[model samples]
Target: MNIKQPDWEAIERAYRAGALSIRTIAERNGISDTAIRKKAKAAGWERDLSEQVRKEVRNKLVRGEVREDQCANPERDAEIIEEAAEEGATVVRSHRRDIRKATNLANLLMDDLLNTIQRREEIEDEIERETAGDESGFRRSSMLAAVALPSNAKTLFQLSSAMKNLQVLERTAFGLDEKEKSADADELSSLIDELSKDA
Candidate 1:
């Protein structure tokens, strides 16, 4: 069996240059990417300047000072700008979607808290009936009993703080909190007035 030594000097030069990806460099040197990564980490190699290079190129494109090499094709500039814009919009939409999901979860928690407080006795009775004595010990019923209700002042305070934090997140996600009259509210008020007139 014959073993060949890897060119460490060439590898170091390529790694420090930060032009080729680690995988590519490792493949060229006939080594694993993990081996190159370990060597790079041990040597404290500088990060790739690809992001910086792209930023500089983007700035130049925005200023209409693109180099001939950059715009090898006439439509490259437009494509790059369009791609960047789509990437930015995707990030924003993803952020908004996550915020919306968090807000929905918070709203559900609030509702659960309110329901448990208002109908504690009824809910407890339901649970008890569902879990009635069985010799076989087959009591399979849990209607949110696992969810601990805030009993003491400390727990209540914590819940309040969490709700307040959710409120702040909601405000930041969507603009400031507004108390606009909803159509449902107006319709309900109209129905009440009509019933009063009939009576």
Candidate 2:
């Protein structure tokens, strides 16, 4: 029986290109899977090229690539801008998306004021829920239980930090959109009002 010497360069290229599995490469080369894998590694057959090479390839591909719409040259850049503007007006139509947009007010600034109104209402409803829970006398016991019975100060600090963060978020959101005259702002205002009751 005769076993011919494997074409090392071809095997390395196949491995580098991911055209052949390690097991398949081993079978073709008449070597164990481990040996084939080790040879591929030793020969500098990279599975993931260096970050610089990857970045270069990305830049090259992006520069070379063209979108289908971009090739449709009759569509002017102004038309694209106008379409984006039209879409932006109604982007926050849904209550959820409105609140989401309002939370990150920078994105929602171009959105219609109605979105901010709707988002404020959602905030108000959540505030009411919390207020009701607090009124039921269950909140104090629960708060105390969680804080007093916690295993360590870390847990208490985490809860305190979370509550403080929520306060900051509400304040920031309020600062961004001062149009509390809108329905959305009503809820947000109520939440801010309620949270700041002690203040």
Candidate 3:
């Protein structure tokens, strides 16, 4: 009588590796998953460190936070690079939103400043018209003297300073300093390339 014995040792190794499902491993080895499970249970088989590391890397990749060392293969490296690019794009879009908001605020401030100046000019014109026939120029001088600072002058100054500061900050955030002409996109792309090379 001849018996075709199964290589239980190899089966156990594959089971502990945890890369393949029990069902798939069983099919490859020409056995039932139940049989493999029974043997694994009897032998006290548990997933090895590689399996644990793979799981951890998988979780981190999904969150776009996997380090290059954790996923050190071409396929996994591509996945991580793509994830990083997506994260970078999201950041860029957010920066764009900030830029738009800052620009809108500046536009509003400019509009208000123009309106305030126009109102001031109108007030001055009205005073001049009222005193047009004053041969002594006394009333015009007195009225002009009573005119103190414009009501929105302080606000206009503050807004102007704030807008200028905001523009500087925006430029800095994007690596757009006058000395550095390179764009943020280039930095982000190079970052992705470096990650891939490290992997």
- All candidates: TM-score: 0.36, 0.23, 0.38
Ranking of all candidate structures by their TM-score, best first: 3, 1, 2
lDDT of 1 by residue, 1-199 (tens): 8799898867765554333456666887999989987987998755333232333333443443433354434354334433433333344345557667776876776676677677877776776776676454334333534433635334457667877886776574343563443233224324323433433
Worst 10 residues of 3 by lDDT: 180-189
**lDDT for each candidate structure:** 0.53, 0.42, 0.58
The best candidate by lDDT is 3
Which sequence of candidate numbers ranks them by lDDT, best first? 3, 1, 2
Instruction: Compute the lDDT for candidate 3.
Output: 0.58
Task: Name model 2 segments beyond 4 Å from true.
Answer: 48-199
**How far does residue 79 in candidate 1 sit from its true spot (Å)?**
6.4
Q: Considering only N, C-alpha and C atoms within 3 Å, which residue pairs clash in candidate 3? A: none
Off by over 4 Å in 1: 1-82, 132-199
**Candidate 2 lDDT, tens digit per residue, 1-199?**
9878778865654444332345655776787879777886787655321122222222332343212242232233223323322322232123234445445653343243335344654644555566574657566445334323242345445545655654565544333433324223224224423433423
Q: Which portions of model 3 miss their true places by more than 4 Å? A: 1-72, 121-150, 178-199
Model 3, 1-199: lDDT tens per residue?
9877778877765565444456656887888999998888888776432323343333443453434454435454444344434444454446557777987978887896677566776777888999999898988877755443654666678788888888876775454673523233234334434433433
